[model samples]
Target: MNALKHSLAGLAAALLLAGCGALPDKPARAALYDFGPGSTPTATAGAAAPRALPMIALAEVDANSRLDGTQLLYRLGYADSNELRPYGQSRWSQPPAQLLRQRLREALSAGHTVLGPEESATIARTEGRLPDTLRVTLEEFSQYFEAPDRSVGLVRVSATLTRSQPGGDKVLAQRSFTARKPAPTQDGPGGVKALAASSDAVVAELVAWVDAPR
Candidate 1:
């Protein structure tokens, strides 16, 4: 009976060891991604200072609840376009609105003096003059799959430009912008690259629109 008990214990110990070996030490973590570093100056050495650009007060970008999270979302046109799904192992480093705002600010900085809403208000109080206020609303941002293997990164936004006056603020311009870029692959990384490209395109359009005579 003692020998039998010893044998059963040994078998149990071996099974325990086998089970431990089969299990992973830690669960896999989701990959985090963001828009890549924007355009870099060609040469900093002896480079001329950039000319003064128009100053504009950029308000915080707004978005719907669906885009307020870090989940990397996608839609299947072939299956059910209305149902948005999240990738299992991928996520944005920040919410889509924040990411778009950062990218837009960076791009606009190249040709404008971008200021926050609070900063603009302070300047208005001190200088008695306010720069035009720009408000943006993110309407759509996602990877859209037309077919099982074909996809594109899609983005849409609405922009409103307003000027402050003694009486009240006046709307100067309002427009909607959309951009789509084909994904290099049908995976998360590819979606990220495509979205970044689409965002850059949209930013360029916004800068041009703002710079145009108003």
Candidate 2:
């Protein structure tokens, strides 16, 4: 009986080893993504240098609660467009708002001296002049799937330009901007590319609008 008991224990140990060996490997870590390095200026052999606009302060970009996390989100427009879903294996390197702010700062710097709110305030106290301020609110940002195979990255935002005055801040202008770019493929990676492209397009429009006569 003791020998039989030992034999049963040995068999149980062998089965346990086999079961452990057959278990599937651990799932892969989620992939991280961000807006790619922004566009580089190319020299036109004889093109005149672009004139810089007046210095401006950019407030932190704000977004709705839906975009407060780093999830790569999407909507199935064909089914329930209002329901947002996140990709399980992909995520943004930073929250969408931070990413947008970084991109905006980079683009705006090309045409003007970009300052933070604090920096602008310090300058105002010392120099007696306040730079114009740009405040952006991200309204909508997600990949929308028209079908299982067709999708586009969509972005929408509102911009407010204001100037400090002796009494209060004066609103210079307010405008809404939106852009959409079709995904090359209907997957997380493709959605990232499409969103980046849409962001660039929107930023280009915003820059033009900001520099336009007000």
Model 2: per-residue lDDT, tens digit, 1-214? 9999999999999999999999999999999999998877788899886687999999999999999999999999999999999999999999988998899999898879999989998999999879999999999989999999999999999999999898999999999999999999999999999999888888889888889997
Question: All candidates' lDDT scores?
Answer: 0.91, 0.93
**Cα error of candidate 1 at position 94, Å:** 0.5
Compared with the true structure, the alpha-carbon lDDT of candidate 2 equals: 0.93
Q: Score every model by TM-score.
A: 0.91, 0.89
RMSD of each: 2.2, 3.0
Window of ten residues with lowest summed lDDT in model 2? 43-52
Consecutive 10-residue window with the lowest summed lDDT within model 1:
43-52
Question: What TM-score would candidate 2 get against the native?
Answer: 0.89
On residues 66-173, what C-alpha lDDT tens digit does candidate 1 reach at each position? Answer: 999999999999999999999999999999889989988987887789999889989899998799988999999999999989999999999999998889989999
